[model samples]
Target: MSDQKTGGFIATAITSIAHFLTEARKQPALSEEAGYGASPNLPKPKPTLIPIMKIAPAVGWPEGKKPTPAKGFAVEAFASKLDHPRWVYELPNGDILVAESNGPARPPANWSFRWWAQDFVMARAGAGRPSADRITLLRDADGDGIAEIKLPFLENLHSPFGMALVGDQLYVANADALVRFPYVDGTTRIDAAPVKVCDLPSGRNHHWTKSLVANKDGSKLYVGVGSNSNVAEYGMEEEVNRAAILEIDRVTGVSRLFAGGLRNPVGVDWNPVSGELWTTVNERDEIGDDLVPDYMTSVKDGAFYGWPYCYFGQIVDERVRPPRPDLVAKSIKPDYALGSHTASLGLCFADDGRLHERFRGGVFIGQHGSWNRNPPSGYRVIFIPFTDGKPSGPPEEVLGDFRSTEGKALGRPVGVIIDKKGGLLVVDDVGDIVWRMRAV
Candidate 1:
């Protein structure tokens, strides 16, 4: 089939699936006794409609701007021995919680001579063992600037990604659902059982989950559901394949799709100044280095970003071909393109209120190193400047030199968070450390 025809078919299939799911959930089943006896009664649910909005194309950065170095950011290694730390949340008492994504290894029993030989041979065979996944709370008990480790907050999570603190509650985004626990101040252990807030589709592996954010008032929660496959061309079901952003009511567990056509939005945050939702999306790869551009965009309600059939601020997807001619006029492009394959992971707005005047109202995103390109790109943090709630310039490297001169990386950053004291904490999953950046 032609690219245009394929795009149309995919779009139609996705819409039909979404509609069916929505309608099926709304319908009520008939009770046999009520049907045979008195008047049947059933409450009708409200119809939900997904919104689609148009966004303007992004402008590129000005000429002759050099990338900034990490030294200028005054990065200091704060804590170590973190295995795949995914997200960091700061508490009111100057303590921080770090979520590790790996699973625990089984302890070996007493060794016999034959068992020792077998273990040694197996170790040499290089079998991959599961690592521990736990949440650790760090704080400085003394006046020293360094943070000391506390007891594990929770253990045996299935790849927890993002966390949020609302009042006395701590909500964590686990692989298949949102789990919550009562977070008492100055306590290392959560004595209560975790309550399930929302269940999400997970474990397809192609797109792992990340980044859960709540509105300022904690009324709504947003979760990122990544696409099941790259470009959705593998003929996966629409309910499982299409990339989407989900919004749920905090009081109720009811959730609905907030936006569609976003492939894998790794980092999502609400702009401190504008209160607008912004996301850093990892675009589809393997078509060429620059065919589709990864982006940091202001997500809109019901926005149709051309995924599978369009990309990078309205460039018709050549692989999908012919393109959706109807969508060509309506498809909203990204707000700012952060080069192709930058692998943007974590996003946080600079609310220090003390950054360089030009740095205020901007965002800091951790690019988690890339693998598709020749020279290898994105092993550093970048800045996206905004003015009056819109991006003013292209993404500029604010933290650099994480990658070696030959482009090999010594560390990979996964999530960025601002601590209680207004310092920035970046999680380096590859280096197994968390680095803190503070103003000198």
Candidate 2:
């Protein structure tokens, strides 16, 4: 799977074409600050012939070098050298489960320019590694902020991403379905087979990562399913139950659509202050540098945020044939824009006094960084303050330098969570490390 030499020549040629296209493109109409906040500046449309393809090849971190931690905090590697670690879940007993996974091989329906370009880009961005298909358990028995033991907790998963423990059953959101297994507190391994809860959308599987979360009472489950193709290019029939959030009953496994038109809501959590569900969504691309911005919003039940037709609420995308003006009229504007093409994929709000008091009432997000925009954005961890369940202050960079000085991706932060010891843990999928940051 790590075969760079195979498409090296074609990829090199494509890079040259990309540079020309970027230069021909107009500069961003909105300023950097306009790309964020609740009322972000949405620029005019200037769709490109092909998606803007640019990337900093993923190169493992150099020995002894790591990300720069925010002031008043110290950072350390919780676990290192993992194979494509993508997401994390902390058990009630303080055990951390990291999903070591990569997308399963999926060829395009018919090979074309877009397909080849995406394939080359994904491989160079540290996705060339095959899925490890297992969740490893890390334990900090001594509480030194470093995991003392790293063991295979569960094996043979199908690209598992989100995990949660509710009572005696552990729910794992594999790409294809929701499954459960028997669990014992403080155990290191599970040999028991999983019971399928329900199937998830996976055909074509353009966006295969299915993020999962449970309710406060643990009586219900929410799974975020992404669109199978960009803008429903493959056909709307393939997009059934996609680009929407599915709510499932833990008892009967019956699922229903919670919200729709989110594009790709990779993370979901409940707002402790407002008692509302929220999600971070990745917006549609290939439009322009500032036309669409990825955002986070309070997910209202039976709501449609508008995908493949509109973005940032009421702004219609003309590319979609057979216009849906009715849907555009009802599109809900997001609560906050995370910057265009920032690829904001992970979200977790601070509910308790877990971390430092300065960061007590805010949300920690992991922006996986962007390849669709030049001068790449969001390769770090950021904290946005909130009050009364709404964002109140500007964002602060919590961790940075995810890419090397030579324009190589040293890491790409994916999932962010608060550990049992009141510390922040970030999953760096590209660097293959889980970084822990605690107050000094």
Candidate 3:
């Protein structure tokens, strides 16, 4: 049979097997409580021949519907009818920039049954859309907590995820490069051509979305580059300069690795109190549901956290060949765990105290949920309180009910940001809405 025939046969076989095997694996033995804070103990690995497939199918929210906010908070649709708004950036003037893009298509190199299955999951999760390649500006204009005017701020770009502004320059992190354009105060649109800052990893981008951040003085830019494969299954050579955070000099565009061994670092931020860089990392899969917990950590310069060879600091993976025990020995453990396969992607620190006291000084994370776990987790936005620059307590849900009682997804939270007025903004790609959360 031809390749298409083989692929079809395998896809059908896997689908048939998944129904029977969904209940074969055990539920989380320990409560998710055991998976947070600075010292998360690694659970014993339970490798599986087939991953548990329990995905919540994406279903658009009905009219006048929105996510349920935590007590003392209310949610309103800040803006609606967007084209896959995956990331949100608030300008100094309080204008919100929404990145309307998706994963760019690449060359069909490594087509297999697993690849097809992965694609299916993405489709059901509402991520298999073509890139819009534009950034939209939403303005409330009257401090009403709802955008009254919407404008296309920038257009004709690659798959963009992160945005940063320094002085007169507005930088946009596309899938394959970092580029910037001149920005004028109070201007709604940018027409100037973008100057390339540096080229990023592309093509077979297993982790395509590159999250960008800048230092306090805007002297350097930090780009989070995820690994090309789950555990370097495609060979170690393909991972050169990948799976690391590249620090770039803002003036000259020269880049160097700041940290490595992160499987997929999706969210990047600077802790306001400690003035340290932190990120949310998505760990490897197929090693059972609760084995390797997705975590957040303070990124140190010239540090390795162990991707293919080890995980969570010196826990051997045993799957890698020619394993260098030296590198594993140097891997630093993460600061806090966000649970296994939660797909924790968005991170932002809260310093403003205009909101409720409970959420005044904390870090809000957007967990996009997961399909690999049998009893699905993380279809919500959570808050991790911080005191004196460190996580002080376990995570608490800030927004929930994105997934319906019937196991259908009304939306999945992705990139999160704080509006200039101190309200929290969440990007729900599946529902194509930007939710504004604030004290009621």
Candidate 4:
């Protein structure tokens, strides 16, 4: 952007700070109790012009410290001192790729007051850094928890987040589009120019990260695209082909919307037993802290889960003008609630069962945590039990204590995946650490 835009954002940031101080918003009416399991109790919608602002400032962890894992498990820094490590992917050859990135500057977003406020919040949360625009490879050649080899795998990219390998080709999901490059087994670095797969919605990218997953046969790709605005406050036209997952044809490079109204779907994974696609979605905010619950659910093709119009089934959000009852009626309820503003992002299935038996055959969720709710939620990794391919019970905290006693954020969990040794790898964006969890 321009200097004028930057000045305007600064002004808006000041106004947001003043508004937050002046407005004593309503506290959470219900605990996270109403938000969890297969069927959560949806409370009444509490709309507001000013959202509750409670940001946990990001503070780097002290030396020789790490996250606290649950019982029967151990946690250690798999990789550390990286620049904004956001997402991780494990290759078949036991190599791990970490996408060290941040959002790109969008000129259109700089003009909006909402964008200014959000930009201020992200800066406080240590997410306002310039994009590193690269992926680094980490190798635990000795089977130790720590990576023994670190190499610059792929560099000079645009806000890349997700990766998928199909045979000799590797696909990358950037903020604005999808691209592919040829891959060779055991190759440490890729310097080749990528083939442009397709152009994704690249507007004032409020939600920048695009997650990718390939079908079993590697013939198709599933990419998660998030909403352009909080709840279409910038008009519905700006949200076209967003807040959903898209299916891309591998050969033709053509893409189509697979699911809609997901708000901010982040992590995409395939269920081992059910053979179905599942995603963790961050629900809409600005309503009461307890209104709309973030969720994880098995996705169906062409299904709408309600964005600006409704949520958690037919609960309507009155703020959206010219309501679409037709779409709301068709909106499908989610499978499980992850609590409002939890920022649940990373998702992976525990198909290998390397952890304790209690964690076997469940979903591991990396919650990046929240800033909009008082007594903030979601700063660690959680496990949700799944029986017969569906959510069976409430989530259990697998790793936690991301916040200090004074509420300073020590770390936040992001992308999660099982490494070659069946160890769980979690990306800590703010702390610049990748934590490895294994059975003790």
Q: For each candidate, what TM-score against the reference?
A: 0.74, 0.96, 0.96, 0.95
The alpha-carbon deviation from the true structure for residue 179 of candidate 1, after best TM-score superposition, in angstroms, is 1.3
C-alpha lDDT of all candidate models, in order: 0.64, 0.88, 0.87, 0.88
Tell me the tens digit of each residue's lDDT in model 2 across 181-265: 9999999999999999999889677788989999989999999999977787877888889999999999899999999999999
Model 1 residue 301 CA deviation in Å: 1.1
Candidate 4, superposed: residue stretches over 4 Å from native: 1-29, 108-110
| lDDT of residue 71 for candidate 3 | 87
lDDT leaderboard ranking: 4, 2, 3, 1
* Candidate 3: tens digits of C-alpha lDDT, residues 1-440: 99789867876777678767776545635664556777776668878787667788898898877899998889999999999999999889889999999888866875655666777778878888899999999999999999999999999999998899999999999999999999987899998998999999886888888889889899999999898887897898989888989999999999999999999998998888888999999999988767688999899999999998998888999878879899999989888989888889999888767666666668999999888775677889999999988999989999998989998889999999887786899999999999999987
The list of candidate 1 runs beyond 4 A from truth reads: 1-72, 102-131, 142-145, 236-242, 321-329, 354-358
* Each candidate structure's count of clashing pairs: 6, 0, 0, 0
Instruction: Give lDDT tens digits, candidate 1, residues 1-440.
Output: 99678756855554465445534544342221111101112222222232111111111112322223444556666677665566787777877888877422323543333333323322222212243457788886773446776568888666777788888888887767888888888888675777999887764445656568888998888888787666555444633523778887877978888887788887888887788899988887645434355777788888877776666545565555445767655668777766655678898887646545456788888987555433345778877777887777656766665655444345667788776565667887666667777665
Per-prediction CA RMSD (Å): 17.8, 2.3, 1.8, 2.5
Backbone clash pairs for candidate 3 read none
For model 3 the TM-score comes to 0.96
